[model samples]
Target: MPARSYLYVPGHRPDRVPKAAASAADAVIIDLEDAVPVAAKATARAAAAAALRAGSGGTPLWVRVNPGADDLAADLAAVVGPGLAGVWLPKAEPAALARLDDLLTGLERERGLPGGAVPVVALVETAAGVLHAEEVCRAPRVVRLGIGEADLAGELRVRPDPDRTELHGVRLQVVLACAATGLPAPVGPVETNVTDTDRLAHTTATLLRQGFRARTALHPRQVPVINAGFTATAEEVAAAEALLARVPADESTAVDPDGHFLDPAVLRTARETLDRG
Candidate 1:
């Protein structure tokens, strides 16, 4: 999916799901993990499941299921059905994904959906998860990966770094994992500065430069900012289109006024730019 913005709606607040789905976000994730209190998880799961069944206003619907070993089964049972695009396995590790892949396969069949219909988006939020991200990327049914930096900071016992300087290696490792596994470039971590549009846009642009093609948003206002950050600019799209236009059908190279020799590699980049638009 070409999701530029993935908006998160708390499972406990089902009322927000429809609103979020209707927003400019390319996808909406119903969160049953960090957003909901432990005592309210069951109710939140039920609410989120109901919203999924109701439909997503043409937006893809994902569930960020609680991944604790004891509660994972319950979370899966409640949300694994029609309307679920995938699951966001939080604090995800390879062992959990392997188990989830098998269990999700069975659930898909039992629920009358095609096997592997519901893919996974692994959320890497720990130092261990960052180190072994490639393993998680290769896990069965995982389509893409996500950076949960807030939780990762908590795991590391470090304060959240607004500049994300502390996460430089972590982000690089996650990108390398996707590259190694042939998975799509993963979405970046959420930006907590929802109200500060300037900061939000800057952060999203910064992450995009760092190889994050998409980002999760805590609020709907952030969706458009993320989308704009990930989207190709009009000038960029025109340049890409022009570059591709100059390529002869027989050869995949184009030269500019500077006479720099362009190659098939540049052609691929141009196509990707157009695709992003």
Candidate 2:
């Protein structure tokens, strides 16, 4: 909900759930999909349900359910209840989202919860998911979109360079889809090497420039870097403040003392920068 940092705690590790919730992350996601082993999915589901009831400190708690029908049904049945902030649908596509919406509706009605109360964050990971990104973002109850880089890379057989240039287009596709649908900018993918703070920060900066307002954190240490990356720097804040002071709010166009052209779009960005700061 804060759109700064989303920390992931493996559902099978219930002990880590509270710890993650207490971290600096704006939200915590209990991963019941890739993070859980096939044999332990049931265990993970049960743990996720318990975590939901216990609460997520002050942050929102989301459960990332599996995409498969049987597994997803079990996942929703176990975790869709009080204290659950939303559902993160992995490998999300239009049809899968439709099914999820129906399932959630029935679950909420059966449990006496408010209809459409649960929001969904769709993670587009597969080739089909990426191709149908706009439709996925427009799906019912979908509040946000995210990319699953690892799965996506595997599907496309792309070995990106250190800068991840190969996936740039894919990332932009998700960003454009979110913009077109008027949803908040999509969440950036998690950087798997938790120990590499430098790479984490660099990639986070890249994501920020590419229209991502938040990123997923695989470890608590990654939270600070992500939070900082999304925030406006002092230099950025100063530039924004200067530009705003030079141009009136109602003015659509202006020229600064340095003769730099300022348009409505630039003014809007300045205001947004101040807000972020």
Candidate 3:
């Protein structure tokens, strides 16, 4: 299944890393930017490197690095290694990502790693970055895109509303850019209201409908809800299966019992749903 939920853990909290890895989350992001204080960045990098070395097996493990910070070089040096899956470039700009691509390339070669060994995930958190999202998504090493809600709101001079009306346009733009590049749609910086699980699930469902394949969770309790929202529903799966079963073998098109037209594309989607289960 596509990774649909990413649990964010502060890199400085090494103890949390192991627990996060063992969670049901599809991916875990060891955050070194907003989650880590400046003085503790070095320590966070070291801890994150150790956690990566410990092994995530198959679960995607990514490290979020400060993009426009002076410590980025050192952050890259500490986090980019054989066991690390990818790097999340925060506050990423198109030109900056191009530079990051080069840096990652050189680092991989120097470390005797294969080309494109470490994919970069750009975090579009600024008006400038969102405006140039297409270029950023097309960067050589970029494999995914993300949104930083707080930073984006600040850049756009808007309040961080739970509904995120102001960000809807940029969010759609990011999704479009990702789709155009054949990359996973950007996920959301979901509301961190763990006590309000219903609201959390509702927010996640909204993003899922908008074509996002994943979402970030600050609290462990949010993981399962986010996963549930992103996963294919039983009703949807059943509908897909019913449609596929009605089609004759070797036939690419058919008419459903309801007189609706069915095409190969519909069958393909149905097959995919069952396969996912």
Candidate 4:
């Protein structure tokens, strides 16, 4: 199954790394970019390397690398290893991802790892990034796509509504790009209001309906909410199972006891729901 929650721990906070990995989060992303200050870049990079060496307690460990040439070089050099699950490329564009793909290729070979072992999650944060979303999604090693709404709003100079309705179009664009490229649904943006559990759950549900299967989480507290939002509820699973059981073996259509018609499409949806459960 696809990841339901990705908890991001700051690279500089090495103490929190293991804790986050052990959390209920489906994945742990040690952020080396944005979260780490300029003066502490080197320190954060070293800390990230150490965290990778320490192991992830069986949880996937990803690193968000800076987009700059120098920092990208330093970050990948420090963190690329067997423990690394993938790289999150910020401000992702096709060209930058090509460079990243080449770098990761060389690093994998040098580290004696299998070729193409490390995947990438391309983060679209700027107007250019949005416009080139499909290209970025299609880039080598890019296994998934994500939106950085906070940064994108800053770039676009638009303050979104409380529900973030204004960014819906961009989010759909990302979803379409992923679908067009045969990639999984995009990971949703991080909900920064750490204390607002209600809002977090509401927005995560909205994202799930908007074609986002997973969401990046800023706090461990948000992990369960996100995971629950993405997962099929027991009632939903039971309903799907019932629908499937009512279908006739030789027919593409059937009628449930409640007189509801079940067609091929409905059967497919039921199967998908069961699979999700």
Candidate 5:
């Protein structure tokens, strides 16, 4: 899966799965947590499990299971079938991640699924999780991390700033932790103001500049904007190609004919941009 833009649909509403799959989203998240009510947990779990088994049109179906102790075992059991792409562990802490790793291992062996096949997206939403980001990233089968900023802001007592300056340090910590721990760049948090396309695009661009490669979306309309934000521009691709053409692969320390300095880091970045497309 491309994984640049993720669309989250309520798990209890299985009808919405096909619509989300048919959209331009790179991935679809079947949300059992946060979206589904407590009374509907059993129904949503069954619905999500069936959807996972059914599989959508070329779209990977992932489940956001409840992270609480009372629900974790049941939620994981309900959703750990053959077609589950992965699980999203919300409010991720080091201890919880370790416990999930063991549980997933057991479930995989019991179900005859490939061991380590089902990965986890650790949602580092709390101050404690942020402080333990490195340990969380180091946990087995942990693929990537995401920010649940709405919950985090409340925990940190941060006032909502349209400029998002308050979140800068937190985002940097996540990015650095991921880089140091060998995970792909963490997915950016969702933009809440979906109705304002201009604001969505602006926020996406801001996230991109801040080293976020992908983001989550609440609505279908935000998918295109999220994809566009993560993808390298046509001009950027062309420039990278031209740079590679001028410089030999073995020669990372070279200067271009147009007097541009080409260091190893710059060359590596060029290669990554071309690879991203």
Candidate 6:
């Protein structure tokens, strides 16, 4: 669960699952909703379940389920067994997540798996959902709070601008809510265009700066850019190490080598970053 760069692969495209599972991404999300048509939900669910069973070790595997759909029960039953890491509950409200929690709990018990074996990642897409994001994040199995910008913009009656000015407030709200709840802040629905690597990198860098722990990638090609953006640069790692090295263990605060005042909180973060590296 280290800060991951998750790439989304359409579940119906089982042929692509192997390549996606073997990709450089920290995790791969097998998508059932939005990516798969209603008619093909069953097929996608089976494909995702098969992929999970194939067992791509090391790389975490998550399945994005259709929220509140009648097919969701079957989807959960198909993929919530062993080898599955977690479920990405899309357009999730607190109530929906609560129900999903119950479903996963039942599945775990029925399958003889450890309790709480599967966690949930809630995707907040609407204004109401974002407003109640804290409650959603606080739900029993929620590991992260995800933002779905496309649906959010449609809900808010706005167009998708390149700079994403319209979604900035909502995105910040999601991040702040996740931070307040001690949950991971999800990154953006970055551009799917493989040719626009520069934009993808820029978007990923911006999200990281804003405290997002992980980002979402629609295309596999965007994986490298997202991973690169989320990774700590050598300079950043060196600076963090240098700051921690200069601080005395007993001293809670001190002036750094650069002559800037460093507080205990700052020193702690520096040490944590170095340790993470």
- Residue clash pairs of candidate 1: none
Candidates ranked, most accurate by lDDT first: 4, 2, 5, 1, 3, 6
Better of 1 and 3 by TM-score: 1
Q: Pick the candidate with the highest lDDT.
A: 4
State each model's C-alpha RMSD to the native: 1.5, 1.2, 2.0, 1.4, 1.4, 1.6
Candidate 4 achieves a global lDDT of 0.93
Candidate 5 CA-lDDT value: 0.89
In terms of TM-score, which candidate is stronger, 1 or 2?
2
What is the total number of backbone clashes in candidate 6?
0
Q: Name the 10 consecutive residues with the lowest summed lDDT in model 1.
A: 252-261
* Candidates 2 and 6 compared by lDDT, better number: 2
Residues 1-277 of candidate 5: C-alpha lDDT, one tens digit per residue: 3479889999899999989999999999999999999999999999998888888978888889898877989999999977788999999999999889888899989988888988999999999999999999999889999888989999999987896789889999999999899898889998888898899899988887887889999999999989988888999999999887877767767789878888878888888788666
Query: Where is model 6 more than 4 Å wrong at Cα?
Result: none
Please identify model 4 stretches exceeding 4 Å from their true place: 257-259
Across 66-123, the per-residue lDDT of candidate 6 in tens digits comes to 8865767888999998778899888888888888988888999999999999988888
lDDT of 2 by residue, 180-270 (tens): 9899889999998999999999999999999999999999999999999999999999999999889876778899998999998999899
How much is the lDDT of residue 228 in candidate 4? 90
Question: Candidate 4, residues 166-214: lDDT per residue as tens digits?
Answer: 9999999999999999998899999989999999999998998898999
Q: Identify the candidate with maximal TM-score.
A: 2
Predicted candidate 6: what Cα RMSD to the true structure?
A: 1.6
Give the Å shift of residue 256 in candidate 3: 1.6
Ranking by TM-score: 2, 5, 4, 1, 6, 3
| Lowest summed lDDT window (length 10), candidate 3 | 268-277
lDDT score for residue 144 of model 5: 93
Worst 10-residue stretch by lDDT in candidate 6?
268-277
